[model samples]
Target: MGNCIICGQDVDGRICQSHEEDVVFDFRGDSPDQLVRNRFYRGVVDGYADFGVFIDLSPNVTGLLHRSEIDGRLESLDWEAGDTVYVQVKSVRENGNVDLTSSIRQSEGEFRGTLIQERTEEKLPEEVEEGNGSERSDEGNGRERGTAESDGGGGAVETGVTTEAETETEEEPEPEPVETVSEPETAAPTAEPESEAESEPEPEAEAGAEPAAETETAAEPEPREATHSEIADLPDRVDELVRIEGEVVSARQTGGPTVFELRDETGVADCAAFVEAGVRAYPEIEIGDIVRLDGEVELRHDEIQVETEALVELEGDEAAEVERRLADAMTDRARPDELTLVAHDERLEAISGNLLDAAESIRRAVLESRPIVVRHGATADGYVAGVALERAILPLVREEHATSDAEYHYVNRRPLEDAVYGMNDATNDVTKMLQDRERHDEKLPLVVLAGTASTVESEDGLEMLGIYGADRIIVDAAPADPEIAAVTDVLVNPESDDALSTGALASSLATTLNSGVGDEIAHLPAVSYWEDTPQSYLDAARDAGFDEEHVTELREAVALEAYYQSYSEKRELIGDLLFGESEEAVAAAGAPEDVAAEESLAGHIATQFREKLDTEVETAQANTEESEAAGVSVAVLDTDSYTHKYDFPPTSLLLDELHRRSDAEVTIGIAMDKLWIRAETDLDLRAVALDAAENAPNAGISAAGLRECRIEFLSGAREEVEIAVIGAVTEQFD
Candidate 1:
């Protein structure tokens, strides 16, 4: 029996049952699942498939492959498709019939190839020997053939004639099997095609596949990096752009933009997103709507602004749910004691209602312990109108204190006097009202006192009654009423009685009264007397008499009635004593009419007294003058007993004459003793007596001879001397 050429197995007695030819075709276009047939190849190793390992098949696809089917060795094989492998078929079926029972397994070891070739006519040496039955038999035949060929040099050709019979046998068809079993006992093994034949050589395709595989590996995206916690925790920067998602606690659509507040559990932030689409888009974003927004943050003075780019509305329930979740998150992270929910709802309400009151409440809550500013307003009448307080002092003031219907401003709890009036008018009003009420023992509440000035002025009997008392007036540094100085006692300290001056008050009152009276009674005679008057008695006589010429003459000769009338009362009595009582007696006697006559007689009497007095005065003046002119000493003494004791000579008369004559220096002294005069000139005795004592009877007097006179003059006087004079004497008689 001969052996099979492909596997070195004996196949001499066996018909060529496994002989078959397969038409090689590229099946690469078909999907991997469709490529296999039969139960053995269903999920088993079929041919070496070139589909990319982990690359082509997703995790889901690769997971379906059986590990045992992939490679024969279970314990050693990795079983992942990524590992390279060789698959082999143990059986094949005819006419599209697949015997699933036919086994398919991977090769356990390395593979080797076998060859099949057509038969040749020349016998091999081994075959020749076996046919001859001896090694020497083939050797003798070969030697005889070689010796004969060498001697004859002739090549031998032999032809066997079985061609017709062989050709007939090859052309005949084989008979069908008598009994055909539907299923075979053992399936014939089928050879697996080489990996290079099974998979088309596609270098460019693999090259292309490699980049795609690489690109996919590269295309796998990574998770984004998280922002720093601290940076994220801060409020948005002044002008940064950002996005925030929250529920709309409140929404307001003005003519310009839709302003709304977004409240996350963390805090409320103001957002103003402009929507030209009207309320259809904006108003729909209600107070409870969940919204996601993109906006820019801006800081203006003391406030923060968020300008919105986009605002997406969400369902109310969803928004509430989100709000609750956010609240929970914030609450979980916040300190328990200090937990505060600064939600949009609360802030919206705060801004809408009494902002000032809200600010006050917030100030009380947040800045309760801090110092506050108190500011108050002053009215035109110097009264307090209003008050405002703040906790912190600002360097610059924004509002001015109003006066006369103006508003008041405050800074840091201090009154801003520069901005407003300095006076507290309200306090003044209150004081006045309280005083008024108190005087009547009235128990009026302060609330009633808080009314306006006009209201208080209209109150019954309260106009005249000021606070304190009528005299108790406010004396401010700045007085509103000009007449206040005239009415009230403006003392430096109004509260103290010692500061009050009654005389000054009376003077003020008199001045006021006089001013009032003077305006009406300015033309009366008594009043005119205090002003300028007529020149003299002659001028008065001219006014009262009949003829100016006669009156002038009469005034020269005697007194006129106008003259008498012109004299004040005290002067008139002296005139009457000098004149007589009747006119007849004077006319009959050829004297002036008694009125004129008495005036004439009185004139004569006065003339007699004056002439006698004048003679003595002239003589004394002459003597004093002569003495002074001659540079001599002169002295005079009064000899009248009563005069000696009681009267002192008038020195002013003598000094007057002496002053006219003497240029020399002089000195005078007075005591109780006799008169002593000394001068640089010699005086005549007559002139000395006449000038020294004009109306006195002169006793002969000399300085050296006056010791007895001095004693007599000194008798009734105090023991002290009475008069003395001293001067430079040109000559002295010793």
Candidate 2:
């Protein structure tokens, strides 16, 4: 026998049985039937189609990598028609068609095994020598063990590595074997898998077992009804019987237990259900299904886990009752623990229900395995809000999924300039979702508009999703148009309360969405505001241990990072700056290095923020054309001429700082195609546009914002249009 190239185990062929799928092969087989299913193969890029990429595996064999199989934005792929890529052979159609899937590992270095040389009839030199020896041996017994015959599901192949296969991997008992619970008196479910009880000795009956007094199990009367228990409170109730009804967010059959991730409104916990060795318990159970379960709390590996006894799917009215209770509990429990000094404030309370609704949609997306795409403005407030949701949702994702890359797969934050979700962004989402649907069979993601898309300018972009029938949620701290709120599936706007920053609203929402990450993001709301923060919010920040200095550093640091990558959300940097003080994260020697790293990074970025803002504001203020129009102070700047329009510290951020620095009640920035607005008081641009159209028939202007003062006007009417628009906007203050 020869040793397997991987793991150095004795094998009949080049690779071990388990690692057969790890190596990508250069397929020479002409017929589809000759190819092995579930094997990785090296293929050449043949061409691309709108639906998928065509790959040439061999002279007569080809496969398709559907666009849906890609992991990122398909448009960004730098692949050409002739490059090589690795793919997994999924299946071959009866009519000679081949289907392929994206390999999790793309490079040869990523694989842990070696390549096998496929040859026709003739065996390797070593095989020929062994055959000759067998024929010549006079005293040898002619006993033969044959290789595995296909059962058609990538069934076992003989690698001649019998040591581990016979002793461990193939015969090893599942981590925890299923057993029939011999509880004194309990009714059994209709179906149960085979049990290990008959073959194995019970843990309690094993030699060197603890004495009777050491056993935690006591013959006590069971409660008439199962006591409802919170997952977090399971530790205190160890050795006690309890029941929890929640959605089965995840389930996996292991050697020892069928672990189910049960999530209720309160929190998530794992419930281990076992029936027999290597047997799947509750064969009909699946993820995303609701179940009512009874289990005794147990401490395994210093973590709270449930020792499941009875598990049944809650159906009909029973299911409806459980879901209704869960929603009520979530609405109450998901709310931020304290609204800061602002929690009891009259204004925020007015729109609290809307916040809860938006939070519910986001949380539901997590439970349903739907992707969440957060589109936020590339400002400190937008980044803070976007990161707030990211912080809250990521932990839930890690808990719910077995895949290591689930966070990246299920949640994405895209930054938009102008704080608007434009058609360009909509097109990107549409292409991505369609591809995901085709490739991975993922459902269309729930697009959440936060910190942006609360105005008329974003309406067209948001409505674009209707072509695919995708739903959206909007949570804005800006003065939003009421119409935008009405159109969204879920909307939480500060206008219903009072003018608040999106960061503040998102922080509160984050607490309700996942309080587990709330403390890490508590300082975000205060960081969102440049100045004039509410007393209640400041008090909340203070309570969360954020001083004014730290808040300022975070605010400036986020602004700096946001400016650097205006289009891409700085997820990692923002998370570190905002949540560096996490107690859960520890480094070597336990120095709380994450906290230290965050402070250093924030301080450095804040320095850059102050210096950059100072320079940009100076340029904008110097170039500003301050004039009086119809008894209103109007500051008009030729933004295209005066500002670095295409670099970091985007035009919106520069204009915002300029408007704040200059004493301009109404500021109008004229560019080639669009007009930018910033004002001390809310101006009715819709009225101004109508007035301009009435006075100058050729002006051709349209209004498009709530708090933002942008409008669409003819580029040819630049000088004349600005004069008319400024005059019309100035008259509004009257």
Candidate 3:
């Protein structure tokens, strides 16, 4: 006997037959024909389209509640994105399009009924003769068969989804029984059973007819409760029937099957369940529902995924047990084995918890097969850190998936100019993710911000992602800001510490995400520094066999390549320069020339790096001007006249070099609209910008992104703004 998930009644099936009619099952089956027409179902709003609201009935089944069927305008329905709604399946077309009618009533509190009948599509109304004892059983097949001709016709293929029933199944399988606590979706249309009950009489049967007799058949095999399988074990169990249980993270309907992302204690897997042609099946399952699944493991298109056969919702004690099990396992390996610190400092120690959370979020992204997009500043440190993460995650992706090209599809490193995640970048991400969902039925990606997320300039972009439920993680050396920290899902920033560079923070976080690549990432911190290498970071590199000269070559090489496109991560080029990767011998034969060529690339780039930075510095110093305010002296450069505006060496990198050579207390590089500064002191440039704006009212000055060695002012008011900025900045020192 099994216990019903809703009422705890012991029964012969997953749910009791008595309460079957009272509940709506989460359909794990494949077809739209399986859904009962005129049946109200509980659903979550997946998103809005101009024509209707797309409501997710089950993880794999979504139905449209059209504006024509709704009581109010679609915009005034009081529904936000992802809100739960109740709607009725008015009809199911042969091509699997489900036309839904809206319900004013929502929630189970409004419904009244005892469900004695579970899902049995073959069973229909039987007419009974009023004066005779005989009855005949004959009912409509329930499917409104024919081609769907309208806007809803093409929606079946929205996500490249082919009907699983028509293509994969050889024959229509017997319909299964379903039961769950029925939650009414609207106020009265679906909730009022008394009116319908009083208006229509019981179904009648013709005289001289008999009910269909039950056929004698072979006894069915008894089903035993299945034990769960870990997703990590799936690669070894290909073609084998296995049982696994987990919470559904996401669900998307494909042309063939409804894919549910099932995540358990160990890992995550995509389990595809099928029902019928174009028709939604099992209208009750939802994302975040704890369920047990039985399926065969398969490799589809070189990627590991599961083909589901049977599924059961686990609630009450079962759900709590599964959750506790997962939590316990998470506590064990959610963080790194230990910290790979650049230096043993109190600031790093204090933020260790945040670091662990950030690392765990990246690791979880890989486990769930979601793409990881790493955005970082395009500088020596930024490239090194981004490369280190790529190195760590690529190997794991290859290990977890059967596809050789999974790295390209599952992981990406995007370089952001000036380490600022901007609105343009966020819009691009949203468009790509939405297209991927509509074209391939994949989940939204996880975004990891390394060296770029701490700046408030990224908040608008982050909020855009949050609208679609994309996860954002931040790992940076920049001091924490409360506003940015609050926006991030997991924030890893060394509070009040500016000593660590983006490279150091990235390498450390990368190691925490995947420790097997620690050796490859250990030398990264040293390669990020153009000069003044911290002793501990330098020692870590020396121990890895990189001396000062070689480290300098690496820093220069990466900087030159990083500056060229500034937007192109050039992952392979950067990875080759930093780690010297050579292709392994092919199945037949290969040459040593390939390996030799790989090692020479970095040195060649380094030579070019020196030539470029040297020329830019010479030009900058020749056009330099000096000024004094209070006791502080400043060296200012007209970047338009000196530095290359659209070439190698970004304004920030150029200013850093000029500052190193200057005897002045501060160095400012001025361009058309903004100014970049480098200072020997750690005063807040944001404060100075505010003061300058007040002193020179027409300048319109503000801190450009982070409250750092940077500020922006109106280009039209440059002369007056410069004077006020110098005065305001100097007063802070006094």
Candidate 4:
């Protein structure tokens, strides 16, 4: 007996029965029968086959880690031959064959302790032969080696056979009870007629599936027409046999069965079919194929699933009718009835038609099981917009997909460093989506650029997505170039003459996507606005139980956090702040402690936000270079020289806060290579950049990001570019 290393409990082996899964063992035994079932063992990757990977527990005993046992595509595995890996022994067959399943603990370091599992009593065939005869039997070894090479089967192909010759001097029939039981079972037939020897390995080869195949054939039910039922109705008819006709949304292989996600006009459900353990059931049926499935309804872990008996791909008129029905149903269900604006505004009212179109595109993507990737600016307003959309779409994703974690699978929100979808961002997104398509048979995602990539600067990135037939949607509060409208599938830009925030627009779009959560998101639009919030939105926020003080705390907290990790979604933390509810409270059915925690967290972050912003603003105000151009107050601060670089509150965000505090008519923050402009009067940044470039040709001036009215110039000509920009600003005021 031994004590368990993890739990300190006494057990028969090094690890206790309850903690057996916690530790990975190194099998020191030579035979497959020595391996304890359901225990994790360290194995070496031998080779790869179409069906699975061959993992050798030792030199003689090998197991099949089938493709279905893999969590992802087989091609995605980085394991090479001879590489050390961990696998669980699911079962062992009578023919010395082993079956393996994927181990949750892949690394040896994850285990609390490691131990050697040795069986000292059982001996190898060669060791037994040595005791009986002084010399080994060459003919017996040759016949076994030849049989091993000739047999093309799934079970244990190599059992380390040795000679079974009874007499020491010459060739003879081997004695029984040679200790190595497998060798005689195989080598005994070799001593019979040549025909019998040839046929002997067939049964050994088919040993893995013999029992299952025989049971399946014998228990085959008589043909009968099953009652047709919709996938939505399967939840009510548990354990009942029924037939369903739908389109295959996705097909995934598990260690035991192939789970196919079938979607009909009503809903989606998982249909599991098993041909054998760790084998693909129906290889011909693929995503988007119309098929008829006969199965028994069963509820597993509160999720309705069908245990498939037979699945057949439909054709001709039957296929056409199902396809047409699905298309019509999706169209009716995906599109929203009307545009529901959180707050009434003339700018938003004018773009109601465009907002509805964009909302419909997002809704359709969810219903079709296509992933929705939202790329938004990494700012308070941008994060609010992204979170608003996430809040609305996640519930729908949960309802539409049969999987519990469908929200993470179907909806993704990626933050952009800048409000522009450049080649780098497009390339990363394209690579991931393409890999997901090839590996998992997922459809191309519908890419939504919120408060970013609506301008002409992102045309290249948009065109790249267009080339792959990925649908694009843009929602921006800024004035967008007219040329970009033609390229995108839907454009929701008001092009309003008044100042507006992207959060205001996107929050309304979120409501249009799912109106059931309208009350929860009513305050989001107000949180996006830093100053000069519309009266209607302010009133709406007040009605949603968020006063001005609480809203300010949320806004400041979101902005402060948004700057630290500008490229990550930070889903849970942001969700807690925006909804003012903790995960614990929600899990406990809306406890009041979460509300107090949310307020406390927001207040703490907001305090830090003020402390950080105040220091930067004080430093920036001290080093300001003030002047007057055509009676308009102008201030230029060398941001690189005055403020902290590569720290919290990035240069762009710092400039925005400073500009808001200043009483000047115009604020210009000039970095070494780029400059940001904010003006009280209507100023066209693109025209100003073009004129400045003409005035100082050597400066290499160009408006790189029109979303922020940001212009780029060569650092060598920083002085020249500054003078030319000031001159352009003077002309605009004059």
- lDDT for each candidate structure: 0.28, 0.67, 0.67, 0.77
Give the runs in model 2 whose Cα sits over 4 Å from its true position: 1-344, 466-469, 495-497, 581-595, 663-665
* TM-score-best of 1 and 3: 3
Q: Measured by TM-score, how close is model 2 to the native structure?
A: 0.61
* Lowest lDDT block of 10, candidate 2: 136-145
On residues 298-335, what C-alpha lDDT tens digit does candidate 4 reach at each position? Answer: 65445677867568888899999999999999999888
Residue lDDT tens for model 2, 571-626: 65566677664333234224445456556667777888888778877887888898
lDDT score, candidate 3, position 201 = 57
Which window of ten consecutive residues has the lowest lDDT sum in model 4?
Answer: 134-143
RMSD of each: 61.6, 13.6, 17.2, 12.8
For residues 574-678, write the lDDT of model 1, one tens digit per residue.
223222344543553466332455444444434443343345445544333222323433443232221212211223223333344444333222234444343
Candidate 4: C-alpha lDDT: 0.77
lDDT of 2 at 69: 81
User: Which pairs of residues collide in candidate 4?
Assistant: none
lDDT: which is higher, 3 or 4?
4
lDDT of model 4 at position 352: 86
